[model samples]
Target: MTIQTNICPRCGKPTEEGLCPQCRAADTKLLACEPRVTAVYCPVCDSQKRGKTWSDLRMPREDLIAELAVSAVSIHEDAKNLKVAVRSEDTASNRTACTVEVEGTLYSVPVSETCEVEILWQKEACDRCSRISGGYYEGIVQVRATDRKINAYEREVAASIAEQAEESLQQSGDRLSFISELEDSKDGVDITVGSQHLGQEIARMVTGALGGRYTTHPKLVGEKDGKALYRVTYSIRLPFYQKGDVVVSRGGYFEVREIDGRRLRVFDLQTGATRTLAETEVERLLGNVRDAESALVVFTQPNMVGLMDPKTYRTRELSAVPWTFPVEGQPIRVLRDEEQDRLVIVG
Candidate 1:
């Protein structure tokens, strides 16, 4: 093959190919020098792929350490807080450990940032989030960070959790599911429950346990009887006409009383086997209450989140956070609206 030379882009030098010496030294030329590659194919095109690049400290090591030490004064801590340090004697080795404090509780973790404390990494701050209060429809803040890897990792985790929450809602027979995507984090995971009233490490633990999935969505589109319930689209298991019994529906359950006009009555499957509900009560029996399109379902048990009495198309007054951990026998939560382009999950 014959080699060709072209004018360098940054320098007035006649060089082989294109980029100049200055650009190469600026870490902008190509990874042919860095060894990092996003792809092994198409060498020239692949080398231009952007990746993370750490910055260097302009101050002396002593000053850098002192600055970090002083900055720690306002570090809001939690169960994962750590006391990090590298003594003067060990400065040569650049070793350190972590001591954390959260909610007045302390714990030690094995962590070391010794080697060369990347100034770029030190520039990062803890992540913060704000979520609405009450119910699963309320979105939440996970965390915030400047590092690309941390951001990517947090996004992936949030996606996994959101995906699970949606699935749980569907399986539980929710009317509709809608939601926004999750945020990133540099400190730790943050999440909100229905109404945004509660957010804590428990959310993180739940997210992790459920393979990073959970939601605060509620049952019944609106609030009733003081609490938000899950609204759903489901079948009403109806029974033969009856006199007096409780009816079940995809939305919730209700008791039947007296019949009115042209209407068919249904009976309860339980002890009130032959009892029939009134026409007005029949309407309640087949109630598929309006759902707020959240993942939270009203059910006494997690399983109940999916159950509805066919005999009366009625459901119990209950809702769930839709949590699941594959490592455990628990159910999984998948947010229905996480798909980009508003795509739906099938099979």
Candidate 2:
């Protein structure tokens, strides 16, 4: 087989290099220079524009390097299987310089190039952050207790619910999903949300978990482009009696076991039966047993038991169910119903 070659113009010789070895070497040296790119980012938000949408600033440093690496280098159309890598990084006072290496095949020839890219960050507030600083709010959620003052534990729970809801909604691309402010008041908790939909969502979630009822009221706040705009107020009312509280309603003594929506599951002290009561029926709360001590069970009977009260240190006969009897000398819960003038044995 005869080897094919090209005639060099300057050297006047048949050679495979075409332009001769000297010219070919010079061309290769010129081709191995560098790439070209310009990367811009927001200094305030630390976010970069990826297509039309902005990327999350919370991404790690390595992820940012990988993202900028591809778009920073300009590859020729003849190059195939192009790959980019970050070789080194230099961080200055306000700007960051990254040496990006690009490797690919140009016309079936392996070639590599590196370029230094400076990430220029400009100061600008993102849409969400700007709106938040502008005190933009679409709705207010007011948390209150029904026929009682809000407790600290319940207030904390409501606040946590609002925070979790805001985070979840923000991740779903709702840029306006945020809690602008959380205020603890005598009534309960007030959460200011960036969107009326988010306010309602958080209110519902808190009420569902803590057993309460909520209602929405719209108020005309302003006008936008000849259209009237209204802000919503979500009023959430928690249950009057929480679990483990002794309450009296309609001349009946009962202990609240569970609360669901506007209804409550309670155990009747008189009949030793479990039943549910509507919110409207729970007229008033007589008292709350913050704590109860185990009393000494002196005598055990089928229908009644004699218990020595821990507070009073006196033996009292309290009614008990046939199956709910405590053993003699064992401890039992003896609750005193001051209004009913009787002792309740809740074992």
Candidate 3:
């Protein structure tokens, strides 16, 4: 029988096949890095652009720099246990210089390589920024109260809700959804949005928190990319009676708790019970619970409680309710009924 042994062709060393591990590893290129790579970003919003797509930067600057550097490097397919280290510095205002070092095993032999890569940063306007600067909007939300103008508190709530909705949508990757402008008009607050989705969200949230309903009206604007485009206007009307209002209904004083259309869910101050009343049954509006006065309790009886009137500085007796017990020498909440010349216990 005859036996044959394989030998390395280039080094004349004993091997399995054509070349030994050390010779093959020496001949292979472990890492190849491009000399330069361009990074495009928005100057206004700092959004990064990659292959004709713009996205918000979600990584730190150092990590992003290292990623850009490593992206320009190509590793050999036969390399194993590869490790890369990158160091970068800003060479100019829009330029960065990077050094990449790679260590790995090729064909069972350790190999290492280092390369230099330069990154050129270019700035351009992003989609959202461009639309905002151009005063482009797809929808408007108009907030108004029923039969009256919106108050300062309502206006503030609307504006705050709009801003929160914008932030939520932007963070959820809806880049085009943004608030273009928030304006306060004579009637109410007007919120202009870049997308219909943002406007709808703002209107829904405002009404949900402020007790109101909204209606949408769409107008044909034009056509884009063979699709018909329409601008929407969301009209929101708040209820007449808001929460915390103290109103007189059917010869009884009640505190408004919630407003649902023409009906109001109220707490009966005289009986300490919760009941619903129609808006038309309300006789008059004395004041809101927010305007209640702090009266010092002078005396407490079995059927009555005596309190010092904050305005008159005199002791006044009021029929006590079973809901709240007033302790002597403590302050109790009272709402004044000017027509009846009396102090009504609020709590």
Candidate 4:
């Protein structure tokens, strides 16, 4: 005798696919979901977020979502913790589950399928107190993104920080080098030198008689005490240029011996020796720029914007919003129709 079987017309299954018998009467639920390959977004700026779902990329939709019971989490594997990795270039959140933003749009980067190392760029997100409006990046907030690997990110960060350190020391060196033309220090503690060329200022100073920027393959940690009580020897990293050019003039030249407010020194090409100069004299000659200053923008006060003049060292205020960002649902007193949709940081 031949056996017969009964199956649901909808699913064409006698059983295992979860058809017929006890499963047809449930409510029909619909949601917005689609399989995406490359997704990028930051949750802090997302209008809405997708609820947690099982990350089974390869599964039949119906069979993939058959919930026996509504539970907190439904992953089949309980012991395997997901691993996430991010690269140095990526400065956004480095999480197994992330709220990442890329170029001001919201999408989730599926880290489960992502790699051991990924190359990403720095975009908008460090300052959190802001919003996204229309297509333009409407808010002025900053955030940091980073990778999962500890060492690579550390190296990148270290390079940047080291650059900043070099630049700062150069600025100080410029001032001291100028003073070396006039007065020398007494304790040698007042003068300072730099380990490498952080920027043009240091290069110009150190290249003294053989003037201009020089690129010396610097050791990672620079040198210490050869002239001043706190003499410095530092490793320098530069561009394609090797052994940065040095210049000589009628009066003298300069080279870095140490970098310390506690102590300082500058080289005199004419004297062909290191000298101790007052930090004050260094300022009068080379230009004493504050460490917080930027090569691009000058500031009258902290948080104020504007490009300050390099010569006079004077600053003017940057533009300000005549009308600030509007409060959602609040009435905006219209002073002028011209200012509508203008730039203001609204909440």
Candidate 5:
């Protein structure tokens, strides 16, 4: 068999293929170099911009460089049936680069080449971080009590729920959701949120977790784009009496067991019966269990149970409730009513 040869059109050289060896090499060299990849990053917050939203970095820097490098690679238009893969990627503090191996058929001939992708990381502040630095907030969440001051427990719960909500929202790709500041004051605990919707969400979460009500008040701050833009304020009000608190109402002392919606389930210290009080009727709080103490039972009679006060060491007889049948030497909680000069059974 004899090898067939053809003259290249441009180079006018005899070759076994369509183009001469020199022409093929020249054409292959015409393939453009890899374009520079750019990544907008917020160094302060460690966030990367994905499309229009700024998101926290989900992958390691090297892996991110590999992905971005592959995407930024531009194959020559003449090179059909192209395939490229990242062979290796290296990243530094402010820069990332990757080596990609490309293989494809160009003009009915197999062509292979390697390209370097350099990702220039531009350090800048994200939109949310910039606004936060400026003290910008679209809404405020004020945690308060319906009938009394906010307790330490309630404040902690509300703040924790708000923080968790922020994390949840951010992980869901909500770039605008952010908490600007959390302030504790004499009035109440205030949470400043970057977005109005986030503020509303935090208020709902606090109310839902702690069992309370919320009211939203929108104040017209200004107009934007021919529309009214109002800043919102969410007032989250907790119940007047939390569970395990001792309250005095209608000359009767009770220990709050549960706040079931519209009713308060309490252990009536006066009658030793579990009773329900309309939450609306809880006008004031007299005292709590902080002053109560456990007393040791000395003996029991038909109507009264004798007990020794741990503090005063004084022996006293108190009317026993039907619900409680104290055994000898059993300890029971009692509240001292100094005005009445008597000890009241609590629980």
Candidate 6:
């Protein structure tokens, strides 16, 4: 009887099928790396660009370098237990040299390879920064007060809200939603935004926090890509009576706690009760609590309290409410009611 034994055709070694593991592993390339790769980034914002899309860099510089280096390397399909390591150094201001080492098993034989890849750094403005530089804006948010100019406090709040909205949108990957300019006009604050979505967000947030409403106006600018482009204006109108205002309503002193449409939520300074009143019921605005003067309590009684006025340095008598207690030595908040020639205890 005659028997046939299998042997590797090229290596002359014993094998189960065609070629031995060592021979096959030696014939295949374990790792292949590109000679050079290009990395695009925004100079102003440090955003990374992958192909045609730009994104904020969320990784450290070293990690980014390692990632870019590994991306330039390709391993053989049959390799198993693959492991890769990268080391990089800055060769120039715009060039990075990287060494990529890979280890794995191919055809049941261990193999390894190391190669060099050069990274060519390129700079390009990101979408948001480009729009800002080119003065491109799709909407304007005008923050104004009803029947008056916006106060300094309102201007500060509006500007802060606009910036916060821009930051939040950009962090959530809305790259085109940016604030191009924040200007303080004679009437109010003007926020120029790169997208109408950002304008709407700022307007909504401002009105929600400060108590008001907004209206939108759209004007046709031109056409792009067979689509009509319109620039929007978000007109935000703050209420006439803002929070913290001391007002006279129905022969009583009340503090404006909130403004809702044509009504005002008031806190009665004399009775220490909270109630709602129509805007037309308010007789006059004394002053905002923010401008209230601090007075020292000279004496306290059941129905009346004596205070040393800050403006005149003279003792004045005012009625106290049950909501707040007056300490004989501590200073208390008081608003001057010029119409009644008396001090109103606010808190």
Please give the distance, in angstroms, between residue 30's alpha carbon in candidate 4 and its true position after superposition: 3.0
Cα displacement (Å) at residue 96, model 1: 74
Which ranges in model 5 have alpha carbons more than 4 Å from their true place? 1-33, 74-93, 102-112, 246-262, 267-275, 279-347
Give TM-scores for every candidate, taking all chains together and pairing residue i with residue i. 0.17, 0.69, 0.85, 0.17, 0.66, 0.85
Residue 105: error of model 3 in Å?
A: 3.1
Query: How much is the lDDT of residue 53 in candidate 5?
Result: 72
TM-score quality measure for candidate 2: 0.69
Compute the lDDT of residue 164 as modeled in candidate 3: 95
lDDT of 4 by residue, 64-149 (tens): 22220111122223213333222223244432221211121111212122212232222233121122122211111111112122
All candidates' lDDT scores? Answer: 0.32, 0.74, 0.92, 0.27, 0.80, 0.91
| CA shift of 46, model 2, Å | 4.5
Each candidate's root-mean-square deviation in Å?
Answer: 24.9, 6.1, 3.4, 24.9, 7.1, 3.5
Q: Which prediction has more favorable TM-score, 2 or 3?
A: 3
**Which residue segments of model 3 deviate by more than 4 Å?**
1-7, 10-18, 270-272, 289-347
- Give residue 48's error in model 6 in angstroms: 1.5
Cα lDDT over the full model 1: 0.32
* Model 1 residue-pair collision total: 73
lDDT of 2: 0.74
Candidate 6 lDDT, 77-132, residue by residue in tens: 99999888999999999999999999989988989999999999999998878888
1-347 in candidate 1: lDDT tens per residue? 22465776777577566665444434321111111112111121111111342122145655544444333333223223344443322222333222212122122322222222211121221111111111334434443322222333444555565556644553453313323334344554444333222232224443343222333433355666897755321111112322232345333233343333334343332223334334443333231112112222223453334323223334323233223212222222222222221211010
Tell me the lDDT of model 6 at 342. 85
Which stretches in model 1 have alpha-carbon errors above 4 Å? 1-136, 139-149, 181-206, 209-347
Residue 64, candidate 2: C-alpha displacement in angstroms: 1.4
Which pairs of residues have clashing backbones in candidate 2? none
Which candidate, 4 or 5, would have the higher lDDT against the true structure? 5
